[model samples]
Target chain A: MRDLVFRNLRGRPGKTGALVLLVTFLSLTLCGGGLVLSSLRAGLNSLENRLGADVIVMPSKAALKTDLDTLFLQGTIGPYYMNMSTVNKIGRTEGIGRMTTQVFLSSMRASCCSIPIQVIGFDPETDFTVQSWLAQSRQGTLKDGELLVGTKVNVNVGESIKLYNVSCPVAGRLAPTGTGLDTAVYCNLNTIRSLMAAAGALGGYSYINGDPAETISAVYIKAADGVNVDDIVNSINIHVRKVQAVRTRSMVTGVADSLGGVSRTVTVLMVVIWLLIWVILLVAFALLAGERKREFAALRVCGMSRARLSGLVFAEAFCVSAAGAVLGILLSLVLVRSFSSLIEGALGLPFLLPSSGTVAALATVSMLVCLLAGPIASAVSARKLSRVDTGLILREG
Target chain B: MDLKAQNISKRFYRKAGESNYFYAVRETDLELPSGALSVLMGRSGSGKTTLLSMLSGLLSPDTGTVTADGRDLYSMDDRKLSAFRAARISVMPQGRAVLDTLSAWENVFLNARIAGVRDESLVPRALELMERFGIPDLKEALPKELSGGELRRVMLCRSLLLSPEVLMCDEPTGDLDDQNTALVLDSLRDYAHQGHTVLLVTHEADAVSYADRLLQMDAGRISTPDPV
Candidate 1:
């Protein structure tokens, strides 16, 4: 049966090629679109998981919370800083749990990659946000003068990154967060202070105060259990002197809504293309029935049962669709993996390719859909041709 | 096995109107006993092929039964009837009645393959038949690469590959030259002489000398009777 199917496909190259191409198109759209959408969803989930802080308190001049790290990717975004007095004042407020501050500093030059890597300085002892995320890529803590690089950082573990004439050895690499954070570097507060002092000696006072230890950029706060985070944000906005408190949910929700809109548009487009292919396949098979009527009649005369003949047609379709599906999924995998960075940049949102297991599951579904599409379209033609009068068709021909 | 058609007739509904009907084969009784070659002769539109279709169980007669060895062919289910046809009957269709994709050898064994007969056992028989039909060297030739006469001979070899008890040929010599036509008729005669029931439909005069019984049709009925 397998030999028969391949032989028949080889017999009519033009028709078989057209059908296979159509199926490949369907599978590519279904699988490729599905993977991109799933990756976008994964990006959002990763952001929500990593941004564990319910509320972020930053200087009022900071218009966007995520822009704090965006400067690492894009140079022109201005950095804002508030005095440490604001952090202390916000910590003393009610309903605050496990608060930590991250200082933002930038270096004018770095030999790591094209863009100047953003240097984020965090208090190792009181840090609650990044340590948990770092646990996935490496163990232990970030020691002084050692750097924890993001996944996007060209430097690898145990490698040295020259920043501000300070050659910092990379202690570990962080797992991909699929955000602007992936492009940044993290280190202890003492190392950042030295980096700041080094920049200061060079006449690069990119921070608010000349003293790095006295100024902090943002403070991440977690609301205590049974306490509303919104209330904390509202209180910080009103009670704080010059810092604006932003809820992480607001940032995440905006991203989630955009991802949903993009998902819907992609899904609708994929559905339209699939539907068009389905209709074309139906018409193709129906016309094939007409063209191959005499051949089927000949089979009937050869003592082939109606059921057997129909099964033969369906089996041929199944083979072509299977070939098309496997090829399409492979192409999808290549295209999605290769252009992931561009996909992320174009969307201006996080985009992460799904894991191998997740991709396999999606490919299986797409292949199954393509597999069924072929036979279902051909089954109609099969039945129509199988019922044809063998004697009449063969006799006339 | 003896082939019998009892009061068999076929009618086709024309698209001119729902109530209109055209009789392709009228009520008729016929017997094609074992060990004889029967030739059915008719002009175009004479319902010769339609009657052969009913007799071979390819077309269901409107009223009557075609029985082989007292077993009604129409009464059998699709699977059983197909098996019966594969085991007991083989039909040589008109025109280029070969699957274009398969080679000449594959076409020859197509019937045996469809009947689920293993190819290894039929290799000797296929080789012998192809050698007899002078298509042994054309085993690898596709249908398009073969001439019409060679293609017809290949189809004949295909129909004979399974060594069925009943062989039906519809215009087997339609596209053959005189030499090939005479060769085919002689083979059909030889096949019938081997105690196999053979029914052939053709307009060629050379077939008359080879027929053990002659049947004639006109306007969907056995209008003329002749003795061969």
Candidate 2:
């Protein structure tokens, strides 16, 4: 039986080869699109998990942006800031459990640091955002001259980085967050204040320490358990002057809507390609049945039953489709792995490919769908071809 | 044992404005005895092939019954009939019985495989038949690569593989030359002499000379053999 199937496929290479290639293209589209969508979902989840703060309070004069990029964008937008006195006012709000202030400072490209990286300043005693995440890796607090680096920063722990004539030793590295924070550096308030004063003496003015009117970039607030988030957010907007409080839920939804649109488009395209492949297979098998009319008749006269003849046809289809499915899956694996970084750069979304178990499960499902399409298209033709009267065929031939 | 057809007839529907039914084979009674080669001769459209198809169970008669050894052949279900044919009967079709993709050897053993003979014991018998048919060296060649006579000889090997109890040949030498024709005729006669029934259908007059018993067909009816 196997010998017959192989010989038959080899006997008519043109039709068989065309069917195999069509199946391959269909499988590639399914597997590739599935992998990309899985990565996007995982990336989005990671970004949402990393935002531990419930509300972000920034100056009202700044542009209202809720995307993930805004959470860790390298440079401040036009240096909009409110006085540090607002921190006290926000901490006294009704549902606020913890409050902390973050100072934003940017390093120049040709400055003493030599690399333009985002510098974030956090108060060690009051920080509930960055300090909570760092506790998972290390238990100690940040000293005055120590810094924590993001995963993407090309610096090693214990190495000193020169920032605007002030140098600090790297304490530890943070895990990847799949956001702009993956490239930012973190330190206590004293370190950022000292760096700001040192750069000010060298003709560049960003911020000055010990000044009565010092301003901070944003305030991060964590709502207490059993507290209504909407109540706290509304209370802050009413009581805190010249500041706007934004909920993290609103930021995540802004990004989710865009991703949903992309996912829908991919699903529609996959369905269209599948329908095209099915139609082509039906036409090809119908022509093949017509061409092999006498051959089927001969088999019938040789004592081959109708059911056996149809089984042979289905077996042939299975062989070709299995080959094509395997090839398509292998090609998709190479393509997705090779261009993952570029895909992330192009979409401007944090992306992490799904785990190995998920990938294997998806590949198996796609290959099975592709492989079954061939047998389904040929079933009707098989029955029609087998039921033909051998007596008439012999006379006609 | 004997294979007999009793009061058998067949008719086809005519085109519009024509007669309602045209009889291809009129009601006829015939008996083909076991252990001898019986030759049925006729011209084209004389219903020789149609009658042969009825005898081989390829087609059912519109009227009456066909029986082998007192059991009705057409009374059995399709599954049992197919298995009976594969095990006890062999049919050699005209106009390229060999498949285009397989070599002569594969074509010969394919019958043995269909017969459910799983081992290589039939290999020697297949090769021996090919040698006797005078195409021993063409066993490895495809059907397309063989000449007309060589292909006919290969078909002969395929039919003889199962050593069937009843053998039916439909214009077996239709495309062969005189020499290959003599070879096929001699093999069929020898096979029948071995206590198996052989029925040969053809239009050529030369084939009548090799018949152990001759029956003539004209306009869907059979008559006694003409005097030599």
Candidate 3:
């Protein structure tokens, strides 16, 4: 019976169209679904991997906001100045193993291009997280006036790039991290302070005009091995006047939650899209089944078992869906890779390529959908065909 | 095994004004013995095909029992009945009931496979049947490519794939010319000679001449042979 169904499914002309349409539809939906899921997973994973410091001390006012408005939402950052004095104070605190400061110099273009790039200043010797990834690709230590470029950085190695009028050599390029780090340029804190001082920018150190300064914007703290991060943050909040301490885990959760609405919206939209595709395919199958009513009646009188007939219908649908799913997945991969930059430009958000797991899941779902659709449509048509009197038709013919 | 329809009756309702019920086949009793060829002859609207359908177990009578090989046809579950038909009985319905997508050989093997008799040997067997029927070249031809007579022959070959206990054919020779008609009758006669019950429904006298017994149907009842 299974063989019979398979044979009929392969032999039928109408099944070809159904298979093409169903597979095409399912494949497209699956691709979109895979992309969305993969990007979300990659984004979260990157966030987890890049969380180096156990605690971050920013401005208390900025920390209290639910939106992380000062750090991410608005272009304007509040007074989160935990300069040299604050770092020194925190370094001396008991249970503080290490501390480093980072100052975010607003987006600036290199001398080669006009496109703005995010510039971050860090202490190469003290900053462990982002620096380690950079150091792995570096042949040697970063010298004075040298910069480490992220994966997406526009500058080439050995290129002389200017940061606020101070020229620097591009030392090395970081690997793709699927995070904001990919778009950032890492330079020593001294270099940033010197550049800002020469430019006479706001919050710049006047002493950096002749020599490098130790002042910084924000401090990242790592608690001692046995010391709890929560305890350190609480103590810092109590003793440190204006600074804010954020735990690494809580910061990730906060960022994820801040974008919760977008995630939910994307999920809901994907469901709606899939539902719409199902309906469209259902209608198509229904019409196809209707068109083949006479043929179905003929088979019935010819002693074809209902089960075998149903199996044939299912096989036809499955074939169509499988084709569509493969095509859709391939289409999605091409679209995601080729149009990633376009998507980034349009949405002002990174577009991450989906992983193999996502592609496999999409294909499985598409195949199931295709396999299910044929029988449902065929059952409806078969019921109507069964109600027909075969003998009467024979006599009339 | 014999195909029997005992006191079978069927009535359908008329949607328009006056008539409430229309009897398609009423109080019809039939007995088709194994290893015999029987013909059911009737004009248009004479209920010959309906009675044949009831005998074949494809249709259930509203008030009577149809039994084949001592098994009640209407009483069996769908799966059981389907199995019974595929294994014990074969039906060649009205018109060219061949699947348009499958070649003649494929159609033959399809039935054989459904009946659980599929073997690689069935290919040569199918080709032999097609050749014997004078359509040897049609083994690889799809239904849409075949003539009406060719299609009927393919359906006949499919029905005989399992060497069923009973072969119920409705107008098997309706689309054939004189030469093909003779060929089909010879096939039916040969099948009956092999101890398979062959029940044929036809309006043409030439088609029924090969039958060992003849039953005339009119209105909704079969007229007794040598009618009083």
Candidate 4:
């Protein structure tokens, strides 16, 4: 069978062109779908892993869509103040394991490189998710007056950079995560408060001289091992007024659900494109089969069974599809890497370049589609060619 | 073994306006003995080619059976019949039916490969056949590049590649010069002398002068053979 396929493939004409088109289409779909789907999956996974806290209590006025958009899309920083007195109240509540406060601060800075950088301030000891990634870096931790920069930070180690009128040393650099982390800078919460204090913007600084308030923007609560996150969120929401506690699991699910409409749109568009391609391929192959009518008829007369003849057509398509897929994958990789920023800008979401697994899956799907299509088109052609009476023509000749 | 078609009949339907079915080949009986060259002579539009097609298992006879080596040709399914013909019989249809993409040698070897002969040595065999037919250097040439006579000889070589037990030729020497005609007839005689059954269908008398026997066809029925 392999020999038969090889011989038929070699004997087939117009194969190179067909192969090029097949691979082009497959590679584009695979690579495009891979990049988008993988990025979405990775982003959701990263968000889920990093939230660390089982439940987040925020102001009820904070809309879910607005908060998510601010956190992930616009990268906007929103501040909510609840008294530190509430922390003790939350700790004493049943089913609560541990609680830590976090203050969010962001600043856009243009350096010698001229690219704007977004800085984030958090408590190092309390921020478990950031700490985990930090531990993986060569320089393990961040110190007061020191900062951790992501892979795209573009600053040299130990470089002095001024943020909010304070010069801080770069302590460590993060690995490239192909996420928004690549564009972020991290510093301790104290440093952010100090900067705000110098600017007369710190809480209680105006009324109490330099005796700053120990208040935080948000508090993260970890649930007891046996506690259900959804139940905790519901319980907290019921007890606390004007505050909404969201579970990490529910947040991820909510985001995915919201993105469902976009996914559906993408899916419908992909299907329409695929159908168009199918029609085009059908016409192309039908004409190709028509042009080879004499050849197929001769093959029939030469004792090639209808099955084998159809197999030959399928084999040719398989070879073409395989070759096209390989070329498409290589092309897609280059395309994703080069155009990721454009895609991110267009979609208003983070885009990750496709991984090896993603590429393989795409190629496999493309090849399967091509293989299946070949036989269907060939069967249509084969039926017409096989039934042709060569007898009259042979006698005339 | 002898090739025989016993009272074979076939009727083809015309378009809706046509009142009757077209009788392609009706009650045609023919025979070709092993090591004998027999030609079915007829003009254009004659049912000679249709009869040969039925005999070769390319078409099923509506009312009779075709037998070779005492095995009924029409008894097997389409797949088995195709395999049987590919393995044991060779047909050189009118005109040069060589595959255009393959080289002369590859085209010939392809026939053998299709018949389940996969030896690399088939290359040499193809070359030898091409050399014997006086187109040795043309082995690597594409069929489109070959002249009419050269293409005809290549087709014959391809047919002979499997060393089929039965060799059927439909106008094997059509549109050829006297020299090319003699070349093809001589090759056919050589094939027949090697104990293979040979059946030739042609309109020209000179084309079948080398045949051991001759059969005439008129209106889809074969007359008794006139001894050569």
| Best TM-score among the predictions, by candidate number | 1
TM-score for the first chain in candidate 3 comes to: 0.75
Of the true interface contacts, each candidate retains a share of 0.76, 0.41, 0.43, 0.49
Q: List model 3 lDDT by residue over A1-397, tens digit each.
A: 4555566666765666665665576566656655765665565566566657788777565554432323332223343344567667777667887887787655444443234655667887788766666756876667767888877778898996766666778888876655566766778777766655654553333433332364456677778899988889888888877777778778677656744655677678767877787777767777777666666656656566666566566666666666666677677767766776565344433345556776677667756665565455445655655565555555445
Off by over 4 Å in 4: A1-15, A23-31, A54-68, A78-98, A103-115, A136-139, A151-182, A190-254, A328-340, A349-397, B16-20, B118-125, B223-228
iRMS of each prediction:
1.1, 1.4, 2.6, 2.7
Error of 2 at A340 (Å): 4.3
Q: Once superposed on the true structure, which residue ranges of model 2 sit more than 4 Å away at CA?
A: A66-88, A99-218, A339-350, B9-23, B60-63, B219-228
lDDT of 3: 0.69
DockQ of 3: 0.35
lDDT of 2 at A15: 79
Which tens-of-lDDT digit does each residue in B22-128 have in candidate 4?
78778876778999888788666557788888888877778988999889998998789889988988898876576777777777766676777887776777878
Per-prediction TM-score to the true structure, in the order listed: 0.94, 0.83, 0.77, 0.81
- Residue A65 shift from truth in candidate 4, angstroms: 6.5
Between which residue pairs do clashes occur in model 4?
A23-A324
TM-score of chain A of each: 0.93, 0.78, 0.75, 0.75
Tens-place lDDT digits, model 3, residues B1-228: 887778899876667466798898988777888888888788787887777777776777798998887789889876687778777888888766666667788777656666667477777777788887788888788888888888888888888777788898888888889888898888898889888899888877886568788888889988754231
Specify the highest-lDDT model's number: 1
Candidate 3, which CAPRI tier?
acceptable
